[model samples]
Target: MSDPNRPGHPEDQPPQGQPGLGPTPPPPPGQYGQYGQYGQYGQYGQPAQPPYGQPPYGGPGPLSQDEITWGSAAHWSALVAAFVALAFLGPLIVMLTKGTQSAYVRRQAVESLNFQLSILIYGIVSLALCLVLIGFLLLPIVGVVWLVFTILAAVRAGQGEEYHYPLTIRMVS
Candidate 1:
């Protein structure tokens, strides 16, 4: 007999052992889609752990030597800004541009900018204090501290170590 409502005609049934009229069986345990085992698709299963020396999930890995060099340069560039009387602009630019590429560079740029901003505030306070003539003594001390700390930051950045500026207000994180 012929059944019009069925997928195949009554005379043309699906091959034996196949799900002719029954629900399809689940795939064998531990086996998934075409890729096979779990974690094959980065989904529907636990993700594979990163090998040793690799960055942890969502964290940046170690910077290369060239990245360290550029990061150090970002710290040192603040000296140019200081000489030009634009202490924050240079580091700000580096932080915005190169920061997207390397986390280390971004960190160095941000620290430099924060330190520069602090120096600017100190310079302004020193100028105001000049009315009492005590700023005359404090201004030189501030300048020396800025120069020395900036150089030390550059050295630390070149060594691929994180550096936070002392006496900085840390306006940027």
Candidate 2:
């Protein structure tokens, strides 16, 4: 009753309790499936390391106090710039320079720049509407909204939260 699929004699049957299955040995000590060795994998069930250039777990940590302060200043600077009629320049400068120092500053600066650019576009449209006298009303409203939201963004930045402006075109990433 030997199996042609098996090399041995008919008496060479699989051990009892292992019918149709020959005894298979376990992997050698310290060797794992494909990964090569045991220690090659961390403690059982532990997650593998992150790929190159990517941050681990929570990603980059929170900003330092100085970074927060500077980031907040970047947001507030837009408000000051508006008074001098150079709203976009403030955040653009902060974004180009201090941006490299802190992720917080970079984000705040970009957000502020986007908001200012949106405001400028709105202002242009409102001025065009002035031909029908609607610009006279819409212009003031736009100004008020810009002023209020810019202040709110500054406050949020001070509190360490990135404030997203409503109606902002987000021209900068």
Candidate 3:
């Protein structure tokens, strides 16, 4: 059943326009806030800006070129080595080893590098524990695990999302 509160339902809803006058005038540029500033509808139902310090469009502009860089997860994911050696561990290492000052870059770096590093660490740890399992067992596991995680990280990177590794040893700055 249709709810009365829902629009287009025959219920207590005010028809658009008919604000008691001619066609509603286009909201002035500042009607919703100043250029590059946000505004909201006022008493007469006009646009007004959001609170101060907020972007005029409601938030900061979309991602920039700097945000979409080579060191980004996208690039890391695409790299063959990332799929082979790092899987998740390579990107994690590279991300952590990044030297840039951009928070975005640093964040991505940390993630990609961390994931790769984790897999590497796990493989090493598992191999060293050969007494518990056969030596060759970890090889295929590492390969498949690396491939899956590498692609996952790469996909995230392509979307410009950051990747972080867990339980990593911060060897480099």
Candidate 4:
């Protein structure tokens, strides 16, 4: 039982204007009070299904001409940064931005990113081998190969054709 001496106790006093009754009972199930029915908060308790004939939420839209241009640019970005040894940043930027809008651009960007990363790995390995004197011979070869493949990929992308670099590890697919 509730204590009568306790402050603000229900047993001590009935609700205002209803002296004979005790504390008011909660609204019955499925009954709405001040807010809507319980658990029906914002964006919740509502059907997640999209209307009929519409694509799913966040699904990739059709590839647009602008997206194709950006896809081509993604490959070219590698060359722009290749001078500074950060070729990955170019494709990465495209993938994070326009890539979200179209699957084609995303695929192109991912391919370039993987190739650049492979080049980085090869460069590092070649540098370590410099201690054995063989790296000195491999370094220039690696650079030339990287340049050629990058240009070829960029050209393919510009033509709206898919390009996959040879000898690239399938990382960040």
Query: What are the Cα lDDT values of the candidates?
Result: 0.81, 0.80, 0.57, 0.82
Please give the distance, in angstroms, between residue 97's alpha carbon in candidate 4 and its true position after superposition.
0.9
- Model 3: residue 110 alpha-carbon error in angstroms: 0.6
Candidate 2 regions exceeding 4 Å error are 1-58
Per-residue C-alpha lDDT of model 1 across residues 81-120, encoded as one tens digit per residue:
7788997888898888888888788889998999999999
Instruction: Show model 4 residue runs off by greater than 4 Å.
Output: 1-63
TM-score of 3: 0.46
Cα lDDT tens digits, model 3, 57-155, are 425555666566645643355355644644555444445554354556555666555555666777887788777776478767865766666666656
Judge candidate 1 at residue 62 and give its lDDT: 67
Error of 2 at 117 (Å): 0.4
Query: Where does model 3 exceed 4 Å of error?
Result: 1-60, 71-99, 163-173
- Among all windows of 10 consecutive residues in model 2, the one with the lowest summed lDDT is 38-47
Clashing residue pairs found in predicted model 2 = none
For model 4 the TM-score comes to 0.63
Candidate 4 structure quality by residue, lDDT tens digits, 1-173: 66789987766666654467755444455444234443334333342344358655545455567877988888999999877879999999999998888778999999999999999999999999999999999999999999999999888888888899999998997
TM-score of each model, in listed order: 0.67, 0.68, 0.46, 0.63
Provide backbone clash counts, one per model.
0, 0, 32, 0
Per-residue alpha-carbon lDDT of candidate 2 for residues 1-173, written as tens digits (9 for 90 to 100): 54767667566667544577765444465354345333325443233454467663436787688878877888788877877888998899899989887777888999989999999999999999999999999999999999999889988988888789999996789
Q: Against the correct fold, how does model 1 do in TM-score? A: 0.67
